[model samples]
Target: MNTEQQVETLQSALLARARALADETLARAKHEAERIGAEADTRLRVREESEQASAKQRAERVYRQKVQAAEIKMRAELDQLRWAHVQQVLDALQERLTTLVEDDAVYLPLLKALIARAAQAIEDGDLVAQVNARDYTRLQAHWSTLAAEWVPGKRIVLSPEGEDCSGGALVRNRDNTIRVDNRFEGRLERLADELQRIIVERLFATATPLAMRG
Candidate 1:
């Protein structure tokens, strides 16, 4: 072991240390670069996810608005249709009802049937078969005949003290305790309520109107 040998050994040791340091630095740099790349990728993915969520939310909002608008339009149309139908029914009933009461030829059979039923419910004296004023005079003309089939002169056919009712008739015994209600308007009112319910069920409640779908 001399001075020269010692110097050479020191130089070799320094060189080895430098090489090791260089390798460590390179490895650290590679690790840092990979970490940075991973962070950037994560940021990009997160940003993309946020953008997709925002777009979906916007689409949902637009769709909901369209649905709402459509619903409002449909309701308006349905309301209009119902209003038209109601008007048509009212006008027809108001016009045709007068003609019905005026025609004894048309009403006699119905009156006879009603009178027969009244005959069963009341006692003989002062039993009044009352109807609208329009039909009263026509019905009174044949009292004996009407009563003959009724209670043998026990009752009278009379017109109620009013202009005219839409439909049906009422038979009243003296005490007014006994009465039969057969009114046209009254019957029509019941039918109208039923019709309203049916209409609602047939429209928005159903898949669609067959005629419209066709």
Candidate 2:
């Protein structure tokens, strides 16, 4: 072939080869871009799902904490109410004892029984008995006869000074080492815990729920 014709054919072959390379490069680049986009989409979806789960967990934790706080507050309020009722019962009991002291027919026999019990507790010892002002006078009038009848084989004497109490006797041994407190206020204080328990059981056994109360 002539030189011009051969050069044209060679040039055409080279041009076709360059076009094929460009097309292949463009296809590879497009495939790489598609892979990178798919990976990015997967990562975004996973991040969204993880964030949603974490947010849900945090919300649930907050809800649980709020519920626990509410329960604790409710229990505290119930306890306060229970104690208030207990105090009322205790006050009523004190008032009842005070009223009992005003009635002599009932109170005098009770007082004698208290003295006898105290003397029995301090058995075989010379005893001293003290009472409140009202009871001191009542007992002093017939102390000897009553004392002999109450505690037969024991030496007993009434104190000149009255005790600060609400109508019962405080009896002690001669040496003051042993004493029995058979007084109204003292007995009440000693039995306070048991009384409170009984009061709660009897008065609040069928108590309504605080939320349902009017």
Alpha-carbon lDDT, every model: 0.69, 0.87
* TM-score: model 2 vs. ground truth: 0.80
**Candidate 2 residue runs with Cα over 4 Å from true position:** 1-35, 207-214
Q: Give one digit per residue, the lDDT tens place, for model 2 in 13-100.
A: 9999989999999999999899999999999999988899889888878887877777778879988988899999899888888899
Q: Where in model 1 is the C-alpha error above 4 Å?
A: 1-26, 114-127, 150-160, 172-179, 194-214
Q: In lDDT terms, which candidate is top?
A: 2
Give the worst 10-residue stretch by lDDT in candidate 2.
Answer: 205-214
Error of 1 at 49 (Å): 3.1
